[model samples]
Target: MAGPKSGAYAIAAVPLLFIGTLLGFVIVGDEDSCVSTVAAGVSVTIDPGSVPQTEIAGYGHEQLVNAAHVIQAGKDEGLTVRDQTIGVMTAMGESSLRNIDYGDWETGGVINPDGSRTTSIGLFQQQDGWGTREERLDPYVTSTKFFQEMIQKVPDRDSLEPTIVAHRTQVNADPYHYERYWAPAVQIVEGLTGAQTGLGGASPAVCGGSLVPGEISAAGWALPNTGPVTSPYGPRIHPIYGTLRFHAGIDLAAGCDAPIWSIQDGVVVGRGFDRGGNGYIKIDHGAGIASRYLHMYDSGMFVNVGDKVTAGQQIGLEGSSGESTGCHLHFEVHINGDTVDPDLFMRQVGVPLG
Candidate 1:
């Protein structure tokens, strides 16, 4: 929730590999050639007026032009660069940045799959009710409509996940559908605007040197609790139940009343006691990634379900409030829906668990 002026946010030197081949771009001052570094320590330059077609590579000239309109609309509306990126990302998911006149239909725009012609159109594929056909087809008009609805639906627009904000506007069947385009959207936005949008929140001044415990991995994750992994994630005998069962989370031995920080920026989805009577908090970090912190002290949660939390922000105090035998923090990570090994997931992201 910290603003750029707070000095809490900084551009981490995280590689743009998530954006794939899009990283091989240079700033071109003229139409003839390109240059490597735009400024000292800054590899990309901001040319908001034009799209980096060479950088984006695969996108056609029309797609790039439509994307530029969306970005320009966000700027005209006085929205943040993050909001503009979300707009571009939504277009990517809805129509691949192309204004199509047909949807849910076979080739040649006939033979409906469900015996119907979907009126979804434009760069966002907005349905017929969204606007008139002429207006829907206009990039600026459609982008304005999308941004206006997004501003109305999302309270803290800048802090919410980009896909969540887009979903609120598009009302897509899959809320996470726009997630895959996020990294590319960000890269495009930065490549064209030169604004380094941090991970929706503040970054640690130094990876491991911040007052917050644990080092921030290159993938932008931090340990939820600063303690050794006492209970590894997997099948194990339940300490309290005295039966063998699948342990869904890894327990960090943090003793009583230890601070629990969020591993990444996300919206708090669930909080309170589970059926087993364990106090817990769940956060949706987008891209189908979610994290949960369990067995917190009865002081309840520091954040509500709808609140947005940044990485390393304390959300609760660790305790033995669940079916736990000792005070510790039980943390879990989920991709899509299936729970995965927390240690392996963390290590894969460049943060090793002790």
Candidate 2:
């Protein structure tokens, strides 16, 4: 088995200068104006409201979340956290967000006379056909060896491209497969914490719900409607702004005044008019996560900021609210202070909205 410490260096070596630089950029304002500071070899400015609202969860979303947990777990096990992105990208390409226990048909490996042992297993899905059963389940053992092979093979570390290239030198699989998923993985990382601490001992955020019993998504665990999702989450034209901005939430497109429900039970966080002149609702699902219901025509809100709600309970009427261009239900799922695509979690429960 590879010494556990070997992998830690791989992950730790890559300084998160990219994230630090990005944050500095976000903090700095235009030089022509005021509110600027020069410090520590860089300039710093602040934009009070530059943080964008985000939503649009999908397979990519889950992969990012899982990757963070995996990274942290690796660190706890005395494994390197650096250069581990290669394994992450590979996992994202192979299984999306799920910690799959089985591999695909083309994903070759182990074999059993009954045709069972060959199944790809666990988060990285090492095949029993290639290794012992114990080895496949131990993420640290599998991931460490994988990284050892990658670093020894690849010469370039300055860019993600060559790093990934080096990692997959033997697969003969498309080198670009892991590269394409990088951006989406980063997006999930940003939305979750605005930082990359990985699982490091940070408890998962507990979101809306009364059960408080089991681990559920920081995003509410239920859908706002049993009705099919009318529009998928992603890039869409702002009906009012007319500028292209990301659609942070999925639109249910339910009939106006129809009963709308909460995904996971939580407390009413806010209910009132948004700057756009449409009535809106915000629910605090706990653990710094919240849900929003927008475009209600009526002034009466079903819950208050502190009022607890049950999952799937009627929370409001679906109507155009807050600068809305039409009479459609606007919904949002937020983690910490950032919005993530609700569709990602929606798909987990097999909700058929879209």
Candidate 3:
């Protein structure tokens, strides 16, 4: 938990019978932001004066309050923290988290081919087709409308990257338009909720409710990334080399920049480019056991050689930097400095990967 949020707002355990005074220590995460459930048809009213932080993610009180409203709408819709983060990310990309009455047309943008200006407004800058002007201007209503549309447009949202899902929902010109705002939106949502929400994408190997996606297993080891195994360890045809080569590691379908965690507490023994300039990091975890992550770009590397890292700590972002065709995580488990089947070893350690 974030521990005793003493900045501006006070969070309470309003959902339970007995409310605790301790801050940031709760079962359902930050209660100050979630007022009531949407199934109850209770309107989430955001009073800008009550917003605690003067700024978060470079946004002032007004913008942050609008974010809270967006989050509140997500909550009302029974969405997860990941979904909430995406909602906020989309809003930030569209309007800088501000509920502006003006839209692209007013600013000489998004001109229609028919010589007419498209009308978009509100925090999401949604077109007039979304709702009436007054409804579009209302943060909660606009956000809810956005969420409803997203649910219909992207039914497989959980399996996709946040920006891709947002793009599909918004139908914006560029798919990666909202990419830069994703990290900031994740920071804002996690800061407000005290919950670990951003897992890069909703990878399937969720062990349990108690464990975050990557931070599973009790034996000082966790899954590096929850993405499913796209390629298994064995002799296989190399995609780039176009020759049958002994595939050394398992490839996960993690997309670009997905946070990859360390599977066990260890010291970084080596980190560099392979013969093909594929970025890799090898960690020695003692007992002749080691692990390595490959294909991360130089910028994606978050640790240096000789640095001690703990299990579940993020080591790098997923990338396709070498002789690879696409973005993926090449993970290898080692025994006595020799490569082993990561899927088998991970399963033996309580965290299984496909």
Residues 1-354 of candidate 2 have per-residue lDDT tens digits of 000011000112122234445443222222232122111122222122342343424544444445555444433333322334345555556566456666644455434445653456555555554366676555545555445555566543322242244234325344444555554544443344344322121111111111122223455466675445766568988777889888888887757656667777677767544434556678887877788877764322344455667777666656664566555777777889898778785676555353
Residues 1-354 of candidate 1: C-alpha lDDT, one tens digit per residue:
000000022323443223322432222222122111122122222333456446463566667778778887876776765677788898888788888875533233432234555567788877666789999899989999888888887764432446666776776666667777877876666555554443222222222222334446667788888889998988999888889999998999877867788889899998655645577789999999999998764332456667887887777767776577777899999999989999998888777766
Q: Which stretches of candidate 3 lie over 4 Å from their true place?
A: 1-49, 113-115, 193-354
How far residue 195's Cα lies from its native spot in candidate 1, in Å, is: 2.1
By lDDT, rank the candidates, best first: 3, 1, 2
CA-lDDT, candidates in order: 0.66, 0.49, 0.69
Best candidate, lDDT: 3
Better of 2 and 3 by TM-score: 3
Q: Estimate each model's TM-score.
A: 0.48, 0.36, 0.53
Relative to the unseen true structure, what is the C-alpha lDDT of residue 195 in candidate 2, on a scale of 0 to 100?
40
